[model samples]
Target: MEQLLDYINQHSSSGISEKDFETVKSYFTHKKLRKKQYFLQEGDICRHFGFILKGSMRQYTVDDKGAEHVIQLAIENWWVGDRESYTMSTPSVYNIEAWEDTELLMISRQDVLELFQRCPAFIETVKMMDDRNNIANQRRITSSISASADKRYTDFINCYPNLLERFPQHIIASYLGITKDTLSRIKRQLLQKE
Candidate 1:
């Protein structure tokens, strides 16, 4: 909770005073998920957004052919939930699953709205997060459509070096929209070049 408050304060345009920050912190509740647990599944209505405090989670969609497409990988201090579903009150297409034993600070949509109404700093933090998310999504889209496999892999490393150690190769490949074999070949080719 302190981590989340600190994160909000850091990202916010203004600092939250200790008493106010405590009030802001009160809006969240703690939750945990074991490895392989589902925070959300396809066709479910997403009710709460969570801030990861510890461990990792993967957000993905399963195709009709039973293939999973990794969309987002979230770890500590990151936020998770199907935003569209949570905001619009619709069923989600993605599954948010715990990749490891995970702890989170969960907040309801109503609480978020209340925060936005009550705290200018919280609004700023949300805006900053939205801007960052947009930039990342745009880069991912451009790389997915135009970049070579090697280039994509390199970009993935540059963007999320920490993830390479945390997630499996196959999972990373899925996130990069590449096959496991292609990722292997790229890694091998790069290794040989080095």
Candidate 2:
């Protein structure tokens, strides 16, 4: 919770007040998940928004062919949840699973609406997050449509240098929308160039 407060302080026009923070903090509940445990499964209504205080998770979807496609990785200080599902009270089409033992601060959709009503600083935080998410989504769409496999791989490496060391090659390949073999080939070709 302190981390979240600090994040808001750093990003907001004026930091949140003690009274506002107190009100905002009450709406959140702490929870922990073990590795491989799911926070949300496909077809479940996403009721809560999660703020990762520690560890990592992946939001993904499995297709009819049973191939998993990663949508995003949520690390420390990141938010994870199906915004569409939460907003609409519809079933989620994605699953959010822990990659490591994770701690989260979560709030129900109702509480979120209340928080927004009471805390103006919280609205700034959400706006900043939304701007970042939009830019990322646009980059990903452009990368998928216009970039070559090798270029995509290079961009991924440059953008998330640490993820290569943290996640398995297969997971990274899946996130990059490439086969494991293709990832290996790209790595080998890059090595040859070096």
Candidate 3:
């Protein structure tokens, strides 16, 4: 959990004293999940907010036609959760699943609210993370509506270069809102140009 503390300290403003950091840390519990394990399932309550200590996870939803649409990917040092369900105590419409053997530090909704109240610096930290997520989501939505498939794939590759090697082609295609065959053609076209 030393890395977790380091991440907080680095991201947080000077308003967070050591005591505040300790208090925030105390509320979290550690857990591990195997690859293919689920952190949250559709229709389940998302009880916890999680920080990935190691490995990766994917948040996605399945359509009526049974196609999975990737919502987001969380990697090491990133946070993952269903904010609406976790905050409101409702069922989640999405599933969060481990993409690899994963370690996480998780805090319950109650504890998260308590941290926000108790640690002033945590407010900024949380807001910063949330802002980044929101911006990324907005960009994805805009791209989906306005960009060509090849352009969207390029943007995805540029934004998450490491995922090319880390995730399977189908998952990457799903994330870019493209088919696997299209992704392959895009990759090949780019390679030919290079």
Candidate 4:
């Protein structure tokens, strides 16, 4: 996809050469999923790493009490997969599901390894994503363990403003580790402040 090429070029130290771009493109396959379809399910091995060409997806886990906890949400231009499972070839504990009819550029684990060796731009993009993901996870962990609910909600809004209208209130609340009622109160308080 052109979008994938642009994304890789943008992330690269020097934009990818046309020769490398063709190699990069060849490694990926286009995939489409309908709303409510799963890209990955718990206990399933993650076989492909996907980049969203259009639409959104959510990665979450369900507890014994049958409560879903949102771990991550991805939209256009975002990458979605169970990294640990993809890397180690283990079963994923989370489910990655499409939130809308979605189109993605997917590469198999074996192909990714081959691409990494062949395309420097693709390698750079993967490295950049890994760094960003680590930083985001660190901040999220700190916030969850120490920050107040309202403060966490505020940070979330600031970090992902566009997601407010994309996901349901309950999903947002779940992601923030807050109750629906608490999220409502927080939203009201925020509006009042504004």
Candidate 5:
């Protein structure tokens, strides 16, 4: 709970007051997920939004051919959930799975709404997060269409160096819209240049 308070203090612009922090803490439930376990499955309503305290998770979609497409990855101190589902109580199109054994501080949608009502400052933080996510998705789409695979890999590495360390090569390749073989070759070329 102290860690969560500290996290809110550091990341949230308006910050959380001690009293408000306690209220926020009271709303959260601790949860654990083993590697490959899902926090939310496709077609289910994402009732909870999770803040990662430990380990990592990936939100992905599987095609009819069963190919996984990585959408987002959340590590410690990051938020994870299907925003549309959590906000609207609709079915989720993505699956959120633990990439490693994970611990999360989770709060239900109702609790989040109540918190926002009580702590108006939290609304600013959520809006900021939404804006950042929108920009990131737009950048990703633009990069996919306009950049070379090598450039995409380089940009991805530059943007998320730590994520490369936490996630598998195949997952990274998928996120960059490249095949594992292509990623391997790019790595070799990069190593040779280095």
Candidate 6:
């Protein structure tokens, strides 16, 4: 809980009061996931939004052809969930899986609603986060549509150097909307250029 508070303090300048933190903490349940475990599966409602205390997670969707499409990755100090399903209480389209042994502080939609009603500052922080996430998604979509595979791979590597090291190339390829074979070819080209 203290660690969560510290993380909030670092990421948000709005300042969560100790009392508010305690109130927020009351709403959260700590959870652990073994590597490869799922936090949420497609066809199930995503009841909680999780804040990662340790380790990494991936959010992905399986296509009709049974291919998994990577949507996002969250590491320590990040948040992961199917926001639409969590907020609307609908079945999720994505699967949220642990990429490593993970610890999360999770809050339900009801708790989040209560927090928003009780804490204007926290609400503001949440709004900021949402805005940033939307912008990022938009940027990724634009890049995918406008950029070449090599350029996209370069942009991804530049943007998330840590993910390049931590995630498998195939998953990264999926996230970039490219095939694994294409990613391998690009990687080889990049290496030759280097």
**What lDDT score belongs to each candidate, Candidate 1 first?**
0.92, 0.92, 0.90, 0.94, 0.89, 0.89
Cα RMSD of all models vs. native, in order, equals 0.8, 1.2, 1.2, 0.8, 1.4, 1.5
Name the runs in model 4 displaced over 4 angstroms: none
Q: Which is superior by lDDT, 2 or 3? A: 2
- Tens-place lDDT per residue, model 2, 33-97, is 99999999999999998999988999999999999999888788889999999999999999999
Error of 2 at 140 (Å): 0.5
lDDT of 3 by residue, 56-161 (tens): 9999999999999998888889899999999899999999999999999999988878888888788778888888889998999999999999999889878888
| TM-score of model 5 vs. true structure | 0.94
Clash numbers, per candidate: 0, 0, 0, 0, 0, 0
lDDT at 37, model 6: 100
TM-score, cand. 6 vs. native:
0.93
TM-score of 3: 0.95
The segments of candidate 5 whose C-alpha lies over 4 angstroms from its true place after superposition are none
- Model 3 residue runs over 4 Å out of place are none
TM for every model, in the order presented, reads 0.98, 0.95, 0.95, 0.98, 0.94, 0.93
Better-scoring candidate (lDDT), 5 or 6 = 5
Error of 2 at 19 (Å): 2.3
Angstrom error at residue 29, model 4: 0.7
Per-residue lDDT of candidate 1, residues 1-194 (tens digit): 77987898899767777876777888999999999999999999999999999999999999999999999999998999999999999999999999999999998999999988888888888889889999999999999999998999999898899899889999999999999999999999999999
Report the Cα lDDT for residue 145, model 1.
97
Clashing pairs in 5: none
Candidate 4 structure quality by residue, lDDT tens digits, 1-194: 88987898878889899999989888888999999999999999999989999999999999999999999999999999999999999999999999999999998999988988888788999899889999999999999999999999999999999898789999999999999999999999989989
